[model samples]
Target: MFTGIVEELGEVTRVEPGDGVTRLVVRGPVVTGDAKHGDSIAVNGVCLTVVELSGDEFTVDVVPETLRRTSFDGVEPGRRVNLERAMAANGRFSGHIVQGHVDGTGTFLSRDHDGLTHFAYPPELSRYVVEKGSIAVDGISLTVAEVTRDEFAIALIPTTLAATTLGRNEPGDAVNLEVDVLAKYVEKLAAVHLPSAAVDNGGGEEDR
Candidate 1:
């Protein structure tokens, strides 16, 4: 698990394509300071296992499935990405729980003068987002300031503007988004008691 607290902004050093997987090397001295092989790192909200480590760089192999599901489909060198090391067992849980699993990609729409930034999310995820709910955008934990059927807004503080990848994101840029897992769990658990929901999942006498 990750805390969605971005430790540093990492830069993609290389992207090598192979038959089935692409090798991605990122330079993050802070996150890779004590990193070892097989450690998990969050790259723009996507959990990736470190396969190799160098001086200030770590490498991970990205499978096709991950590529298709994230904004990394055609990611290239020199792109700045949010980086966070997995939370330590004894570390303080400063932010909400972040699985580093990107649920879907959202589009950066606009940032107003007041730092109210808006993004268009997938319609299916609409139900999980609520005002004041927690959401991870490109691995940085943020609270929802407003929500609509297909979009949500976050109030970005000055620190967020200067520290993470969101600062450099342009309009229409794709960002990885992960909604609060607890909300999803609540929905799933509540579905069991909702007659229509049970039927939608093909539940019947056998399930009861």
Candidate 2:
């Protein structure tokens, strides 16, 4: 698991294609300072296992499924990606839980000078978004400032604008988006028990 806190901006050094997967070599000196083979590193919010390490660069293989679901389908060398090492057992939880699993992708709609940035939400993923809720965009955890049927806005502080790939995103760019997993779990549980709970409460009707 990840905390959605970006540690550094890493640069892709190479992208090699295999029969069924693509291998990426990324340079992240800071995140790999003490890294080892098999460590988990989040690249643009997608959890990738470290397959090899050389100097400040590490390699990871992206499977077909991950490529299909994420914006990494056509990733190329020299691309900048948000990088975060998995949180340590004793580390502070600075951000919300992030699974590094991209649920879908959204298009950058607009950015405002008033700290509010908006993204056009894909129709299928809109139901999981809500005002004041937490959402992960390209692996950065942000709070939903507002929500509409087709879009949502997040208030970005200067730190956020400077820290992650979001700072460089322009209108029409695609971004990986992961909705709050807890909310989905809660919704599922509620759906499963609501009927029974209603019956136990006399279906909202008073009984003498």
Candidate 3:
């Protein structure tokens, strides 16, 4: 599990294609300081297991499914990605629980100088987003500022604008998005206990 708190900004050094898995070499000094084989590192909100280690650089294999589901399909050498080590057992949970599993990808629509950023997402994932709920964008935890039928916005603090990949992306760029897992659980539980609420299929009621 992760806390969606970015530890370092890492760069993809190389991408090697193989039969079953694609290898990605990334450079992260802080997150890889004591990293070893089989250790887990989150690259751009995707949980990747360290396959090999070389000083500050480590290799992780991406399956085809991951590429299809995440923005990693467009990842290339020299791309900067958000990096975070798995939360330690005693680590403080400053942010919400992040599985490093990107539910889907969203496109950056626009942002205001006042720090409100809007993103256009796939319509299918719209049910998962909620105003004021926690969401992870590129692995950084943020609260939903508002929601539209197919898009959502977040209020970014200066620290968020300066610390992670969100600072670098422009309009039309794809970003990895993971909605709160708790919300999904709630939906599933509600389906069993509150059939009327589940009949809405997690979109909730707009008019009521």
Q: Which residue pairs collide, candidate 3?
A: none
Q: Which stretches of model 1 miss by more than 4 angstroms?
A: 197-208
For candidate 3, what's the RMSD?
4.9
Candidate achieving higher lDDT, 2 or 3: 3
lDDT digits (tens) for residues 74-165 of candidate 3: 67899999999999999999999998888888999888988999999888778789899899998888999999878999999888888899
lDDT of 2: 0.87
Most lDDT-accurate candidate:
1
Worst 10 residues of 2 by lDDT: 199-208
TM-score: model 3 vs. ground truth: 0.92
Off by over 4 Å in 2: 194-208
Error of 3 at 57 (Å): 0.5
Q: Which lDDT tens digits does candidate 2 get at residues 16-45?
A: 999998999999999999999999999998
In candidate 2, which residue pairs clash? none
Model 2 alpha-carbon miss at residue 23, Å: 0.4
List of clashing residue pairs for candidate 1? none
lDDT of 1: 0.91
Order the candidate numbers by lDDT, best to worst: 1, 3, 2
